[model samples]
Target: MTPPRLTPVAERAVLVEFGTVVDAAVHAAVLALDRALGADPVPGQVEVVPAMVNLLVVFDPLVTDHAAVRAALASRLADLVPEAGQGAVHEVPVCYDGAFGRDLAAVAAQAGCSVEAVIAAHLAGEYHVAMYGFAPGYAYLTGVPEPIRLPRKPAPVRGVPAGSVIIAAGQCLVTTLTMPTGWWVIGRSPTPILTGDPARPFLFAVGDRVRFRRVGVDALAGTQSGALPAPGGA
Candidate 1:
């Protein structure tokens, strides 16, 4: 099959369109192309950012034009190879009690389910790390079942603590920093997704599988508000 359509986005970036929907196939294509680019470096390439259904490839215009980049990408995409066992599965521990999950009640009401049911659904989801964006180590995850997909908050909440598990845009994310967000707050995780170390700055990568685990409010009682543990443990 032909690869995603590549279109110029500004003077130095190109957007590769996989489709107008979020799914594993679309993400796979994006990852495949990204991997191919990394294996065979793109001339003048600055960075490549993956999204739900697209890949934003930025290059240095001084070294190459959009046409050249597009042609090179086309060649690369044509030879794209799928990755086997592409990403790791991380089980994120989330405290879903009322104190941590502000929108939990509302989400339950919207889905015609009880709070326990909402928690169950969220935990039952088998999600994929679609891409990382919006902030450092902020991983946008796919596979949040539609019933729990609520719209972003009417206004952004200020100072949402790190490790917050929020959902919106038909997906979810584990916050890596204490920052404002418009997404619906659902839970909190103590597992830090970001690290200062250069070798493993981010815990999850594009295509990583994420499963949510329900942690009790007591588990978060003694924890500091924003102090997060590295990548695992409840």
Candidate 2:
């Protein structure tokens, strides 16, 4: 594994960057370092925020300086072992009928395929939770198949419902709130990704794997059980 470059961020944090690109290997390295720091934190380390190609390690300024933190990070990097398949995998059930998939036909037309073919292409993809942003429970999932990949709309659409599964720029996302979006809404999942509990607010963490299962509209009823289904085989 290549050593990550450490850049001082303000006075209390260091940005450990693996690379400039959004490659899976780079993301895996970021998550590996994150796990390392979480398991064995350096002196004064307070928090670590993992991202696509980097992570921010925040330290208590009163307890440690940049030099000391950098030294500790170097030592940890020397001993860091790459972890394989590090996060939990979830199989999400999505309904592609009716209002849930208003953009399905459009996406199909753009991709030069049938709506069913588009759905099949989407379900065939095994996405990874790259990061979470935009909203509390919003997850940015990566690894969308090339055939179904499309750019986000030039303008955001208003009143998009929550639980809507959308894709754009080779990424997949499930809307956590009724908000405007520019991505194509191909389907909606019934699983409650956001639990109101403060202890575990979001359903997915960075690096988790996600697979979609196609289900009919009738199957969506009574499926919102306040938590995602247990992780199972793809």
Candidate 3:
């Protein structure tokens, strides 16, 4: 495998880039480097943030310069191993009826299938938490089934409710805050995915797996206010 290119970011961070393709292999490599750094950090390393295809290593400028940090990373990269174990699998309960799934019929029409088929294809997918962005506690999940995959809408929809399960560009995400989105809102999950506590703010993390379980709208009533139960490993 080709080694990732390291670029200095400002004066306090270094970016380790593993190409620009957003696929599983590149993401695994990024995670491997992140794991290695967490186990044995370079001098002055403060935080390592993983994204789709790169890692940002932040360090204190006072303790070490960029050269020393880069050298330390080079040594560690020579023997980096990708993480092996599976992350926790969260089963999210979603209601796909009526108002909860405003875009289901549209998605079905676009996919050349029935509305039920659209929901079925979505539930069949085993999604992976690729990264977190856009908002706090909001995770970008990959692995949407090919049949139901579609690009983002040309225009953004305003005031999409929190907990809306939206999909676009072969990825899925649950809205953590009330905001506008161009993705198709296929369903809604009543479970609260964001914990307000400072110690643990989000329910899901990068590399975690997520599966959707279908439920009626009645099941969602009065269940949207508490933290989700701890996820279990697959």
| Clashing residue pairs for model 1 | none
Model 1, range 22-89, lDDT digits (tens) per residue? 66677788898888887787899999987877899999999998999999998998787767457898
lDDT winner between 1 and 2, please give it.
2
Tens-digit lDDT track for model 2 on 59-151?
Answer: 999999899999999988888776767789999989998778889999999999999999999999999988887777788999899999999
lDDT of 3 at 168: 98
User: CA lDDT, every prediction?
Assistant: 0.81, 0.86, 0.85
Please give, for residues 46-84, the per-residue lDDT of candidate 3 as tens digits. Answer: 999888999999999999989999999999888987774
Name the lDDT of candidate 3: 0.85
Query: Which portions of model 3 show Cα errors greater than 4 Å?
Result: 197-199, 224-234
Best by TM-score: 3
Off by over 4 Å in 2: 197-199, 222-234
Candidates sorted on TM-score, descending: 3, 2, 1
The better candidate by TM-score, 1 or 2, is 2
True-vs-predicted CA distance for residue 211, candidate 1, Å: 1.0
